[model samples]
Target: MENTTTLGCLVLLCIFITFPRTKGACRFRRFGIDCRYSCNCPGGCNDVNGVCRGPCYPGWHSGNGTVCQTKNIAYNGSTKQSSNYYTFKYLSNKAVDGNRDQNIYDGSCSHTGLNKTSASWQVNIEPPTQIYQVKMYYRQDLRKRFRRFTLYLNDVDEEWRVCYHHQKDSIQSIVNVNCNITTKTKALFVYNERGTPETSGQSYERHAYMELCEVEVYVCSKGTYGDCRQFCYCKDGPCDFITGQCPGSGLCENGFTGQHCQTDCSSIGKYGVNCSESCSASHCFNRQMCHRVTGRCLDGCQDGWIEPTCVKHTQVVPCHLSVKVNSDATELCIRSL
Candidate 1:
């Protein structure tokens, strides 16, 4: 009787394992098995095949049955901004160092105010995808009495400040800041606080100058998913969502051509068919018809002729030849006259 009971339990276990569960089935509790497919899980986290293990997190999504990935977003801008402070201005001046003309500013300050000189050139960032971080590059000029600076994102009101203090003859300093870029427009504001009255009246004798070079923005889809954004040329192919058309490369497939790969090559002359074969050959020797294939004279002249159509002779013979006669003959010798 005990063996019989054991066999029955085994059969029951097999049936539970092999059979498919109905809707709202809690196999995790029924069979004591970590459920691979369960609609009962929170957020409809399809745990089918045990591979689809995790729920689609807040910033993530799953398309295929088992593959969960982040989405891709694109950002559009003429210039990429950097977080490094030295990339602001003074982008390698030629009058400074012999081998390298660029100079670094070295001064000290407390906290003055923001400088808004570059307000005309508005930066429009349209992300074809989502973005996460933004980096900027900047440097201070020593002659200007380098000091502290502030960065403003999107607008002047949103700002972050950093300080620098250490008097030196001349030096260059760089700073990098990571910030979020959720909007289309971003602004940069630099504050020159070299010698403020509140801190030290010593009066920093230099005019603080800042240089910005480049800015880079990092993007992520659905939290940390998708491809890192890149400036694509879209050459010889369809225009990417960011840039309009492909650049520098040949036209896309089919009949496309030209710089933007927009010209159609369908009408271009091809071999055989109705296309003119010898139409481009220059008409030499006047009206002589040129062989379509060889682009040479068809039935015109063999050689030696020089007329426009090889119809006239270039060489002719005179009617008579010149002969020498004796002038001092004896007595009017006209015997045969």
Candidate 2:
């Protein structure tokens, strides 16, 4: 009998080893029942599902990692600059009015005073966002005026960080600069100072000017990536706005778990970090009444269970009867300690 049992176990092990489950031949960024869906996220997708396996690309919402929407956050911000060419025209807000007419006189581009030693244009973004990219549209006819410029980002701390610096004298009409680091910032700046070339010996004879036609700031929502549709519960601060990469562990809310915090703890009668605590111990009236975050019973504990946490059994203590006589009243009470 022992020999037969050992042989049966060996045969089952051999069969399991011979036919291991496979994820199939889906290529990177491809998923779905038949591996026919293409993911918008660069990180690809799980072999069995079309959801994004990683962060979605900027401007693409991570709704299953396949929705695309380009949102320009700068359009709603207030704009300002050091100086303007004319009081009635070339206002700073012109650069963010959702226009790219390129013609400065048409009230579309923002122009700083010529011969100024320093010039700057800035926008205060409403509802500070996690920004990743900035797009600048310069005057098409005078592209050289936008050369040797620096892009800056200011966070809630009011500290300015350099996003990009143009070192060349020749620039294109439209330039896109990647901040490289995603940040929860509130302001964007275009600054230029005369006589200081980004690279030594570069052109510095011309005074600085901020003649910008339009500025578009691209951002992913806080704690989200791609079209800013997914939620990422990072243990530390916010995750990378464009990549969905957390600075710390992939932590979830008390009632949630999984790499993206998508799985609810109640699914497994568990709660708390990683769903390691069992809800069954809560002694709730109904198993679903246990609070996932606090482990407290919502509808009250069952008979013989304690209040609040309901985890402990009620301790029955002996009660002593006490009698008191007053001038006009008699009282009897039972107390337990």
Candidate 3:
């Protein structure tokens, strides 16, 4: 009987090996659905995990469900350079107003207030951003005046880090600058100090006019603007850098709460980038500001308080019965400790 039982077990093992489960393991689709294997790649990516896949759809991710995320391109139709326009002969903001018109006959040549010996045009990328691609279009008609321009990233120490420099070269052409500038910066500068070959520091030469039809600053890689919020949680697809909007889970980063994750989590007991940190109700001993991100007491709780945003209490007093006399009048009273 024992021999028969062993033989039965062997037969069962053979059967299991002959008909192994093949979900995600089948290699040949020619064998039909019963033999087709699959991976966790997005609906279209057939590459193995961790391989550098082709660029996903614009504003989308490979692992994500292909939902278009917001790109972090520098020009959002709102981000402009400094309010200090290059005051040339009549040039002003129109030159850098993001309008690309080659029609010098219609004032495109002088729209940005031309011919300044010392002038600067800068763009604010909000909290400073690592810019990689910078495209500056010289006023089509006044291209000759855009000679000798330099690009810089403003550092926190108030120093300018020169990224690109253009010599007194051809005018009336689009200058596309691509570089690896991966530093978080507050602003980018277009410092054009060179005037026409004859213009001086004190005087403006009509040939030395400096103007740009359009200044477009963009991030290098595709499918991203500056950076995504915590990788957009990488759920459904990705997040938009400019808008702070995500796809999957429809959730924003910490310290932020809203449909689009645009509103910060600010009230009485909270503060931080994500806004999810909780501050102490009584301020952790009643005399200190909690940490903005961790919500810990900056000055520590008083004597009898817990940590990590807990309440504070002096101490619990015991109750006692006692007799007291007021104004020579003896009376029995209950005193609280």
Can you tell me which runs of candidate 1 are displaced by over 4 Å? 1-124, 127-132, 140-146, 155-172, 180-185, 191-205, 221-337
TM-score for candidate 2, residues paired by index: 0.51
User: How do the residues 151-196 of candidate 2 rate in per-residue lDDT, one tens digit apiece?
Assistant: 9999888889898998876789999988864567888888987764
**Candidate 1's C-alpha lDDT?**
0.33
- Taking all chains together, each candidate's TM-score versus the true structure is 0.25, 0.51, 0.39
For residues 160-193, what per-residue lDDT tens digits would candidate 1 score against the true structure?
Answer: 3222223444434444344444333343333443
For lDDT, the strongest prediction is: 2
C-alpha RMSD (angstroms) for model 2: 17.9
Q: Which of the predicted structures, 1 or 3, would earn the higher TM-score when compared with the native?
A: 3
- Single out the weakest 10-residue window by summed lDDT for candidate 3: 28-37
State the C-alpha lDDT per candidate: 0.33, 0.70, 0.49
**What ranking emerges by TM-score with the best candidate at the front?**
2, 3, 1
lDDT of 3 by residue, 1-337 (tens): 9999999999879855744432223442111112321222233332212112334433223334332222334443333332333444335444445456756555543333334456566656665665666677766655655666788887665767888887645544688886555566676777665445455433334433345566666542221234321222222444444443566666555544455544434334565655555564545754435544456554557665554344533333333534343342223334564
* Off by more than 4 A, model 2: 1-69, 181-183, 196-205, 222-224, 227-240, 246-337
Flag the better candidate by lDDT, 1 or 2.
2
Q: At residue 33, give the lDDT of candidate 1.
A: 19
Q: What are the clash counts of all predictions, listed in order? A: 43, 3, 18
